[model samples]
Target: MKKLFIMLLTAFVFAVVNPTKSEAKVMYDGAEVVKGQTGKMTFKKDIKVYKKNPNGSFDSLVVKRNNFFKTYDIEKYDGKTFYQMGQYRVQATDLVVFKEVPIEIRSSFYNDPIYININRDNGMGSYGYYFLRYQLTFLDNGYVDHCFSDGDEGTDCDRYLGTDFKITERIEREYGMRYEISKNAEGKGVPLKESKTEKIMEKGSIVFAKGLEINGYLNVGIEGNDQEYFWVPVNLLKPVGDK
Candidate 1:
């Protein structure tokens, strides 16, 4: 009995000390968009759509066949390749016809500017600066502030300008191709290029203004500090008052 008790205690201790690592869940494949690539696909037959749960399992629902859906990226799950829709995944075997659609830039900034509220927190709603013909660079977190020092004291300083406001027009100047400034041997400021791309705005965040569409990206103006515009996926942004 004592030997058995010892073995159980050792197992418990080991399990507590080095728990089994949970499987990593990937939401997107981070695939680069090639020129003229299309995301529109038609379902071959009625298929079950799978959405990954937070606990590493999947919940499925039936989607009618012959329906069309656009996928942004590819995903690998359970050794199977799946196309990623907004929140749903369909297996590659279910798709039959692929269609090419011309990229469209639909903006209402001139008639009526759309305002949005970023629903993400904890560094998720952060944005970057897009340098034309150069690269998009992520800014440091310290440079961003949700509330400005205008003698307003509230959770988000909504009283200052309110959470919903129209994004101002874009400033017609180029953001130099550098993430930060560095001093050279002569004490002159040098621009250092950053290779890290910024994270996409979380779903449910608001898009205030949209400018141009190129290669699945939209030049958007969002609500935040640092008076400038940024580029994000056209599908990721939703107008204000949308569920």
Candidate 2:
């Protein structure tokens, strides 16, 4: 009985001292870590990129600072946050992640408008209609690519537009302000004033307009409608398109 008790105590001590791999505890008392975050990041300074070894260690040096890489996953290990780029892992502290803001451009005109002309007939003796559509792709480099289709065929023109413009001053659309068509003493239309209702345009709001520039203002459509446009100060807009 004494030999059996000694063997049982020894087995319990071995079990407590050497736990199985599945029973091992991972200790982490760091900040909140997020996983599965995917985005583009640029190196803030020259840093080392590492790859995990088969023995659960990241001692393998893949490469040095390569400037930019697209992150596939974000996770925390050893109380440090790492961004996974393919098989490589980078520390989050040595990189600047580009967080994309939600941007929406809505038009008061028709949504995905399509125009059909039944008068056109193809060589196969089947009538076809024309489809007109416009698309805007916002690039990461502060530029927007505008693509529009012609009424007859397909895409007609593609151009890049600047989107770093901000409203500098308060723009007010005054109501009850009328001008007479006939010339007055000043050789210009006579202005008639009445009680005005002000529609204030918010300052510091980012805006994009047409490429047409006249005087010191840009011709901006009211709601993506080309026929109705208003003028905005050109000095407030800084073009950041590729030269």
Alpha-carbon TM-score of each model against the true structure:
0.28, 0.23
Q: Write the per-residue lDDT of candidate 1 for residues 74-139, one digit (tens) a residue.
A: 433244545556678766673555443222111122232222222112132321211221111112
Candidate 2's TM-score: 0.23
- Over 4 Å off, model 1: 1-38, 74-81, 103-243
Candidate 1: lDDT over CA atoms? 0.39
lDDT of 2 by residue, 1-243 (tens): 999999999999999998766633322222211222234466655666678788887765434354545554344324455566768876666355543211222111223332211211122111211223334455667444445667778775433222111111122322212211111111101110111212223443333454433323344443333454344444544433322
Top-lDDT candidate index: 1
Q: What is each predicted model's overall lDDT from 0 to 1? A: 0.39, 0.38
lDDT of 2 at 136: 49
Candidate 1 C-alpha error for residue 126, in Å: 24
Error of 2 at 236 (Å): 61
